[model samples]
Target: MILSTLDLNPVIDLTDEQFYQLCQANPEVKFERNANGTLVIMSPTGGETGNRNFEIGADFAIWNRQTQLGICFDSSTGFRLPNGAQRSPDIAWIKQSRWQALTPAQRERFPPIAPDFVLELLSPSDTLPASQTKMQEYINNGVQLGWLIERKTRTVQIYRPGKPVETLNNPSQLSGEAILPGFTLDMSLVW
Candidate 1:
């Protein structure tokens, strides 16, 4: 995706509601907000990216369904991070307890909570540094685990709190570890 950022600072600092309204008004567009209130617009994915995203989401959904561990969100689901940024990871999951703690109202709109796990797939228009920065943002905002997958290079960068990122090359699969027990992402499907 070709991600664009627009700074609406000093001129128009949109509140959470206004941002949500803008997104609702333009459902065809995907928007994200940085901690500085800059809006990031994401272009729609091409066939390869879309199909890969779907496959990743399906695996996550299936795992969640079987475990009844938490809720799974696709790319369209926006989350209000603790640091005042709005993000929509390619695939996200929240622990069941954490999800159940939210009020119905909170659940209806962008839930003001960081997901326990997040995944971002590098698209054709994406750069390594940009994707790495986004993944770091997730970690700083209290995400327990994250993966940045680059199909072109067949590599995966793993993120975790208080640790340096772990990079894997052509790994057969990924284990969710204790964070998502028994969940293994089959790299064959992704690669």
Candidate 2:
């Protein structure tokens, strides 16, 4: 890490509220780290990272078939963890009901709870142990399911409560089973 003193102007510390306004002024800037010490998300753009496996994520949401519900490809939306960590998922399933439960005022604020489901696409530079712990974090915070997609192997690591670890490799099809009934993702699209 490079640390250097600025010679242009005196170093100024901005509060969280002030930093937000600065981001507003400079639309091109993306300030992931904040003064409050939030853990900026470490994930990739689903559109670019896994254009090959998109159908899988799409098929899962399509199986759900609820218009008020949908999947998020970019890790833009974030929810604060109980531990104050703010890790975003590459993809998330936001059910209408759970979301509607929030009042308009509350919706404007960071959600107190995590999404119903999360999917993490593994990049070549990503570490398995870190993603595994993130998967567990979802379950610990009441997430129903978490999918860790391995791009190279074209496999998925499924995480569910009270279930054994499952690694499906080039399966004919992938199903959300009961969690997302009738949702079948044709693996052929991914390969």
Point to the candidate with the largest TM-score: 1
Prediction 2 global C-alpha lDDT: 0.60
lDDT measured at residue 133 in model 1 versus the true structure, 0 to 100: 88
For all predicted structures, in order, the TM-scores are 0.98, 0.69
Residue-level lDDT of model 2, residues 1-191, one tens digit each, is 00121221145544445544654675453333322453233334445466754655566556556643543434555555454444557667766777778778655545555777777777765678767877777777777877887767888888887676688876776666565555666766755
How big is the positional error of residue 39 in model 1, measured in Å on the Cα after superposition?
A: 0.5
lDDT scores of the candidates, listed in order: 0.94, 0.60
Tens-digit lDDT track for model 1 on 122-162? Answer: 88988899789889999999999999999999999999999
TM accuracy, model 2:
0.69
Q: Candidate 2, which segments miss by more than 4 Å at Cα?
A: 1-38, 41-50, 53-57, 64-74
Question: How high is the lDDT of residue 68 in model 1?
Answer: 98
- The number of the candidate with the highest lDDT is 1
